[model samples]
Target: MSYDNILALNPRIQAHATLRSTVAKKLDKKHWKRNSDKNCFMLSQPNIYCFEFVEKLSHNIFETIH
Candidate 1:
């Protein structure tokens, strides 16, 4: 079977989420850094999630593994 088909069958694989263009535009330009490809700007010194968010993510991952 194809890679996509295999991923579709896999329980762990899920659809990706994307940032809305309007929300993306609100980001500070000072943090923006041009990529070597010059196609997109990556955020430097981006805001990180809180400890609670990290804990939840770890819990979810652990649950998925088991």
Candidate 2:
């Protein structure tokens, strides 16, 4: 099989893997902060900026499927 066909076989997994990898890098770089009370993580920036970044990444990764 070709390289292109690998992602075609499972786009969701591929998209999630891409997102996870990006998030991991950001975490290592201390771009995201953990919220223990909320049991989640937030970016070290304004809410709008964080939302836009995530939205753009998601859009780019899943654009082909959509």
Candidate 3:
């Protein structure tokens, strides 16, 4: 398949794969099982910033009944 026909996501796939391969070495050698990512967080420092921000934001959200 040519580049014109392909969506050219290999670079992204490889980037993610490389990041995954280093996760253990980079993040305390723990195998995180429960996880979900929907393009909302980047591989770089998501836990230290993005998720933590969302967590604190959600905590302040006022609960209301429908």
Per-residue CA lDDT of model 1 for 1-66, tens digit only, reads 899998898687558975678656646443484534342232453335555576799999999999
User: Per-residue CA lDDT of candidate 3, range 14-57, in tens?
Assistant: 44444445656746434453565455645654467777887777
Q: Which 10-residue window of candidate 3 scores lowest in summed lDDT? A: 11-20
Which residue pairs collide in model 3, if any?
Answer: none
lDDT assessment of candidate 2:
0.67
Error of 3 at 48 (Å): 1.5
**Global local distance difference test of model 3:** 0.59
Query: What Cα-based lDDT does every candidate model obtain?
Result: 0.64, 0.67, 0.59
- Residue 9 accuracy (lDDT) in model 1: 85
- In terms of lDDT, which candidate is strongest? 2
lDDT of 1 at 52: 59
Ranking by lDDT: 2, 1, 3
lDDT of 2 by residue, 1-66 (tens): 898899788746444433458768866766455643442356444577668888999999898788
- Candidate 3 structure, TM-score to reference: 0.27
